[model samples]
Target: MRSSVKALREQGVWSVEFTEAQYDLLVRSMVTFLAIEKERFARVVTVGPRAEELDAIISGAERVHGGKAVIRTSLDDIHMIHSMLVFLPTLFTSEEDFVTRVGFFKENVAEVAAGLKRAIVRTAVDV
Candidate 1:
């Protein structure tokens, strides 16, 4: 799954240039990847003083997911999410630890997902 995500990222799958149908397919693929990793992310653990900060980040992401805020999706935002999903894990001892310590919070995963949703809505409207 990670390799597939990396391959998509390398291919610039999130670029704004994609046709609506193509973008929709890519988004579905991304959503699937996230779903597959959800259990792993939930198992991540954080220790030390930085843990609180990480918790706050997760809370913020939850709020975003809950529609407490509006996020404008940009290509760069999509790229950031891809980087978090693909590259960030390699920097830590484990994928779970990476997520616990900094993944959702640092990467603003919810906001980015919201932004992607907004982009999709915009595309639907445009169509």
Candidate 2:
């Protein structure tokens, strides 16, 4: 998953950019799909990126006066699993576009989730 994320990060600049609202909606949907997969599969999910990495990104964004970033890093470990089981099939695209979009959002979600995890960790560390 980490390797896939790294590849997406590299290829993302060339892909379509989704609006913030779209991104949020996609993430939320992906998360819900993940929950359903967990229930159906009856197994534990792993978070991909570490929380500390997510926190560092958010902290930097805050310093730059970025508005609230709603990327949910806490959900990374399960993003891929959920994506595979739920989101991918429903995208309704040609195999090429579906593959492209999946790779693109997978990375986007992972990066966001990693940042959120970092923020979560930092808050915990400070307390």
Candidate 3:
């Protein structure tokens, strides 16, 4: 399952097949990765202060400014992680234990396509 998650991660975890056990592993791995990322973000946002108060006072705003820049640079990753870890789980439906929809399409696209094949037929004229 770890390997599967790693594969999904390496390939970009837009979609993948997962059993209950694999889902658990994926969630754990994602949460762990996101935690590590959050921690790294926190660590990276800090600016070193000079030992002397004179220098420290002068550079304190630099730290805040740097943090703002870092936050702007990282907001997308943070939002993506947050959506995956927090908002995603709450959307579990009664029929489906999990959802595969993220951006454009469902993760279980093969199944979806198969189900809709007849309805989604192509005509002589192309788009």
Q: What local distance difference test score does each model get?
A: 0.36, 0.36, 0.29
Question: Of 1 and 3, which scores higher on TM-score?
Answer: 1
lDDT of 3 by residue, 1-127 (tens): 1222111122221222233443343344344333443444432332112112212221221122222211111223322432333333334443244443322122332232232222122211221
Which tens-of-lDDT digit does each residue in 11-42 have in candidate 1?
Answer: 33332233232333333433433444355433
Candidate 2 Cα deviation (angstroms), residue 18: 15
CA RMSD of all predictions: 13.8, 12.1, 18.8
Output the better candidate (2/3) by lDDT: 2
In model 2, which regions exceed 4 Å deviation?
1-39, 43-104
Candidate 2 global TM-score: 0.33
Instruction: Name the TM-score of candidate 1.
Output: 0.27
Clashing pairs in 3: none
TM-score of each: 0.27, 0.33, 0.22
